[model samples]
Target: MPVMNPMQEPCSIMAQPPFRSFLVPGQPVSHPDHPEWGEGVVQSAVGHRVTVMFPHAGKVVVNATVVHLTELS
Candidate 1:
């Protein structure tokens, strides 16, 4: 007798999961110009503008295209 493989779950047939390319609210991030601001949590992201709240620098809006904010783990 030959052994049979188990069936795949429904989720396994779905397309690839969402890529983490876009930053969402509450996600931690940092900038190059003001590293002193430390890690900031994203408040909102619209088009090329992103608003984040920093621990020392408070809230600030940054142009996403101009600054490449590093995503924090």
Candidate 2:
């Protein structure tokens, strides 16, 4: 079988920030669509994608455009 290699970007580029996103690392948030995931802490936020560490759901990536994460105080 012929070996295949994944395509790589010519250059690295920064992603555009999500509109009206106030999420940050270590900030607590909850998923409105999936309450079962319970309260989660923000692991990383880049562009519209947010990495949340949930107690029940473990680590999950969510799109801020589709589901607005509820920020906890």
Candidate 3:
């Protein structure tokens, strides 16, 4: 049997309503779970994963579905 690439597979979560509020690159964000990390800027947003650059925590990858990152105005 051929193996299916997960990336190519359709993500059901992406179709959900809350998924519409995904963040984009360069957007400022803050992680409530890790407030000590301070505010961070979104470096990349792919699928359900987001890479954020935090001053204290450095680059961290978080699950968009679970994290619910706060967008900084």
Q: Write the per-residue lDDT of candidate 2 for residues 3-22, one digit (tens) a residue.
A: 54667543335464436556
Off by over 4 Å in 3: 1-21
lDDT of 1 by residue, 1-73 (tens): 6555677455554776532337899999998889999989999987778899999999999888778899999
Best by lDDT: 3
Against the unseen true structure, what C-alpha lDDT does each candidate score? 0.85, 0.86, 0.89
For candidate 3, the per-residue lDDT at 73 reads 97
lDDT of 2: 0.86
Give TM-scores for every candidate, taking all chains together and pairing residue i with residue i: 0.68, 0.70, 0.71
Instruction: Using TM-score, give the best candidate's number.
Output: 3
Of the two candidates 1 and 3, the one with more favorable lDDT, higher being better, is 3
Error of 2 at 28 (Å): 0.3
Query: Stretches of candidate 2 above 4 Å error?
Result: 1-20
lDDT for 5 in candidate 1 is 60
